[model samples]
Target: MQALQSRLQQLENATGSDIWNILKGSESDLIQDLSTLNTLKEDKEKKGREALKVLETKKKELKSLKKEIETLRNEYKLHVEEVEKGLKASGLEMSQVTKVFEKVLEDSLSEKKTKILQIISSMRDFKTIPELHSPLKSILELLKDPNQEKLRSMIQIDLEDIHRQSMEIFRQNLWSEFQKQGIPMKKLQETPNPDEFLQRVSRIFEFSSDLDLLLIGIPNNRIHVAFGMLSNICIDMIENEKERDADFEWILTSAHKWAKNLREVIEKATERTGSEFDEKFVEFIGNITKRFLKKNQKDPLIFTKLATLLRRFEDTCEFNLTDKDIFESLYEPEFISKWILLEIELFTLSFNQLLLDSSSFDPLPSIFIGSASSSTWASEITVQFEQWISRVEKDISSIRNPEVQTTFYECLYALMIDLCSKIHVEANRLYSEASWSNHVYLVMNTIWELRRIVKVFIFITNRERDRRGKKKDIELAGELKWPRENSFLKEN
Candidate 1:
């Protein structure tokens, strides 16, 4: 029995040893798995930190680029503004210079050649006006001479003096201003052309204005003095026959420049007053137009100036034809007859100028007639008719004089009828002459439009008359009823 118990104990010991081995194996595997998990976590954290560092660096670079772009935009804006201001100032300076140049030309032309040369030489170290008077007196005496050759030679010599004196004065004035402002006059003088000089002067002027209103303090007398100088130059140009072509081109170019300068000055003045000028503004324009007409009467450029003046006054002119008074003054039957004749005369003039073959009325009709599909002129005419209709309707209630009202209505009716008939005849002629192209179709369509406009005018007139007649009938009936009631009361 004891031997059997020892064998059973040995079997129990073997089973315990197997279980301990299995437990140790399980513990080792668990430790290995935990170590692998810890290593992976450490690697992940390190990579995340490195990626964050890279993002921060990229963000800072983007910010730097943004700031640089903003700085560049600001710098560019300032540069452009500076450039524009300079251009405006240069224009003003050139105007003043031109005026002074003109005066010099006039003085030179009026004086004797040797005397003028002496005066110019004296001006080299000019200290006083008295120093110039001796030479000036001598030149005045030479003007009494009647010899053409002597006169011509004397004038040429005087012109050279004038050019020299004018240039010296311009240079001195420009140099003084440049020095005071700390601008480089030498650089400006080195500029190749007038345009370049103008640009530089403009820039300087803009800078000056920004620094202070240095240009605004000039006296009224000074402005007139400048104008006088320019006037003298213009006279010289007109009188001098030797430099006709060169002078003409110069005058034209200078006049254009002067006009531009005047416009800029006016604009600046108005801007200072918040873009509103007084009645003096109108007077100023009128003065300019008068001067332009007087100076350039026969020049083709006069047409351009006249057209501009008309445009300026277009908004203010009494062009509405519906008001009885306006219609009577502008387009009564007598006036209409005169105007139509005048238009015909003008049309004939245009035809003569074109040297058109008028044997067939084709050219004449083409000029007056417009297309329907793309005719801007037709559109304008249509709008004008519409405006007349509106004005008639608006003024109908205010019309007091029966004769005047009748005159307006009749004039309007006649005008519309005449225009429509003319268009219809022209359209018919065109259709007969040619197969209907887009242009012919447009002409036919315009005739139809004119017919519609005339019909509308007739309808408006009839409707207005009917309304007034009904109101009159109501008033008449009330009067009759009152009289009948009064008679019954008296009888009782």
Candidate 2:
């Protein structure tokens, strides 16, 4: 057992006997664990290297993507700028083309007519030219050729033929339309007297003539044709006064239809694109006034017609008063003077007639006659005559030049003298009548006042003439002064 103990001690010394041997076994297990850990670390290092290679590849791809995106952005910006330049250039070209088109339309007459017709037809489809896709421009380009005129004239003739056919249908349809509206043909046919109906129809013709001349701007040639027809109708009516009233009514009805047709023709003429007919119409109106004067001679109808014409002139041309052409024509001195003289003559005739027949004198006639004869009776008439005289005086005063003023004054003086002579005759007739005895003192007193005022006016005018030393003015003054001076001396 001692020898066994010694062997065991040697074993213990070799491998740490007694629990040391078990510990040595555990240490071996730990060394094996360390070896396994070292193997795992080496495997982990290999995996790390693989992951680094993948990251490098991904980084290169990302850089390429960023460069591509930048290149694409630059290309897009350049494309947008080029598109904007193209749009601006196109807009400028369109504007230039439009201007060229308008010029062509204005200068080329044949082209204008053709294009206008086309435009009118197109208007049924579209409200405006723009909706027709630069139609005006295209039409203008087509019109640039010289053959457009011949084509236009041919087209016009064809259009007229078509219009004639269409108008027949239109008239028939219009008659039906009128019937549907319940307008009576019998009411339109009612006749007064043959002579009276002729006169009434003449008045309507005159109205239409004036309208055509002053308002519509019809050609002078057309005006002459229309006026001649109207004159013939008037002459026929006057010469055949014994004809049946129905005959006159039929003629008048025909005249109305003719006037309607003429108006339509004038309207069509005016629609021609470059036509300027307003001036011609004005000339035609003047001619009509002259013709009416010639037909009536010195009859009161002449003055009445002239007054009617003046009123029509005012209505038609007043809106264009500021237009230089219209103003010169309307305010011509000779025309105005003639009109004033006619007005004065009308007043004179009516005044003398009223004085001669007091039994038949109405209040209006008496008032007008009395006021015209003497300022003492001015209060008797309506304010209208007084305003008219005041306006006339203002118009006369507006003539600044001495020659015109003197001439106008002389004409007025003649009118005044003629008026005074008529008044004198009326006064003599009234004084001779025994029935006027009760009002005799009042009449004499008014006459005396008027005579005195007239004398005073003459004296003042003479004084002005003497101061001016104008021979014509002096002669007028002496003529007026002698009458009043002699009349006053004779009364005394």
The numbered model that scores best in lDDT is 2
lDDT score of residue 216 within candidate 1: 23
Structural similarity to truth (TM-score) of each candidate: 0.23, 0.29
327-397 in candidate 1: lDDT tens per residue? 12232354334433443443335434422321222223333323455442343344444554555444443
On a 0 to 1 TM-score scale, where does candidate 2 land against the true structure? 0.29
- Deviation from truth (RMSD, Å), model 1: 27.4
Off by more than 4 A, model 2: 1-275, 316-409, 418-440, 448-492
After TM-score superposition, the amount by which residue 204's alpha carbon in candidate 2 deviates from its true location, in angstroms, is: 33
Model 1 per-residue lDDT at 295: 49
lDDT of 2 at 65: 96
Model 2, poorest ten-residue lDDT window?
Answer: 476-485
Model 2, 1-492: lDDT tens per residue?
343344455566464364565555456555666788799989999899999999999999999999999999998988867766775767755456568886775566655666656753653454321343344344445545566665445455544443333333333433333233222222223323434433433433333333232212344333344334444554466456553232433443444444444433334433231223344334434444444444444453344333443544445442223332322332356555564676577556655554565432222333432344455342221223344344445454433345555665566567556645544555456667787564444444444444454455455555655555643432222222212322522332
Tell me the deviation in Å of residue 60 in model 1. 68
Full-model lDDT for every candidate = 0.44, 0.45
